[model samples]
Target: MSETSKMLWAVLGAFAIGFIVVGLSKQEESPEQKEAASMIRNYVTIQSMANQKCPEAILKQTGEEVYFPSETVSDKETYITLKWVGEKGFKKASCTVYGTLGGISELIIDDKVIIKKKI
Candidate 1:
């Protein structure tokens, strides 16, 4: 092959290899990151328990703050979304807390709210 052609092929190969290596390196999730994701999920689930009327306890345990986001209603039932914001990957989470007697709470994460509607 001509020298110029060979050089061009080598440059393209290097770029391709660099992209592959970077992608592989980023595919591995650190233990701390995994833990943070799990914590976020748990935080959302626990906040949903607030419908039972005592979310503060769970919030303290998780060390996450709950914020009221918004609400939606259907068939005379209301659903409330609540957001929990915290550390690492647990930066945001959404949960719904609904009451049988017409109480509603909303959890918001970013622009989305996780809702639980009372039936």
Candidate 2:
């Protein structure tokens, strides 16, 4: 084989190996990243639900402040708690979310249950 052909094959082989390594690494999602993603999804869900259920309770300009206090994971399920505290229009209201990793179980605003889904 020509020297140029050998060089090209070597570069292609290296590129293939690098691609495989990167693909394998990307397939394995870290637990922390998975948890963060789940929390983000929960936050979006809460925002949508609040907009639909209690539009008056949602802030207009900056929206509500979301904080994740705790996350618990078991073999069967994962639990994440999100808290939002700020002024809801003219009143000071707080929303606490009890979210499962795959779904939302409950959402409470100002100590009132806004949404409760069966697990």
Candidate 3:
């Protein structure tokens, strides 16, 4: 092959790899994301069930101070602990996750045990 053709093939190969990387990354949801989503869903459900007993659930991401857009987090790479601190201290609900969308093994709000499943 001519030198120019070889160069073109090399560039195309790089672009193809880049596209594959981006596409694969988008399809895969990080474990931390799955955990956080499950945790948040649990939080919302408990809050709604409280129905005036508990206030809005405020997310407390580990290692984050505060920011706009659901508040930024310094640690978003790993499945760190998350707490849904009940607003105004009316209620507090937290969970020990079972698996990816596997449901919470335990949920405690206001020092009361809501759910506890066997290991």
Candidate 4:
């Protein structure tokens, strides 16, 4: 009816459209990021692994310097099964010699990371 009323309605419509567009775009923040931002915190520690090789691979890999996992937590069907390592109570561990490589991949001990290089 009036010019002022028409302009006000047009501006309101434009704002509604803009809000819709912005809401949709902001939804793409990624579930991983949102979950990480929750009140719960996550920790990631490195561990040793032959990835399935031998025990000495651990020593040789770490140059006899790093702490081996004393306990074991392995998955019967995978290459990574260690739970926690480098704590109190160190123990005598075993190794698997798979050809030229000799280390423990799923040792379930200290950190699952040891190598002629440390993975």
lDDT of 4 at 91: 32
- For model 4, the superposed segments whose C-alpha errors exceed 4 Å read 31-119
lDDT of 1 at 91: 60
Could you give the candidate ranking by TM-score, starting with the highest? 2, 3, 1, 4
Error of 2 at 94 (Å): 10
RMSD of each: 15.0, 7.8, 11.8, 13.4
lDDT assessment of candidate 4:
0.41
Best by lDDT: 1
User: What is the C-alpha lDDT profile of model 3 across 38-76, one tens digit per residue?
Assistant: 777765554334322212222232222211122112123
Steric clash pairs (candidate 1): 80-105, 80-106, 81-106, 81-107, 82-106, 82-107, 82-108, 83-107, 83-108
Tens-place lDDT per residue, model 4, 43-102, is 111123343234344445433433344444433222233322322343333332222232
TM, every model: 0.30, 0.36, 0.31, 0.27
Candidate of highest TM-score: 2
What TM-score would you give candidate 1 relative to the actual structure? 0.30
| Alpha-carbon local distance difference test for all models | 0.52, 0.51, 0.48, 0.41
TM for candidate 2 is 0.36
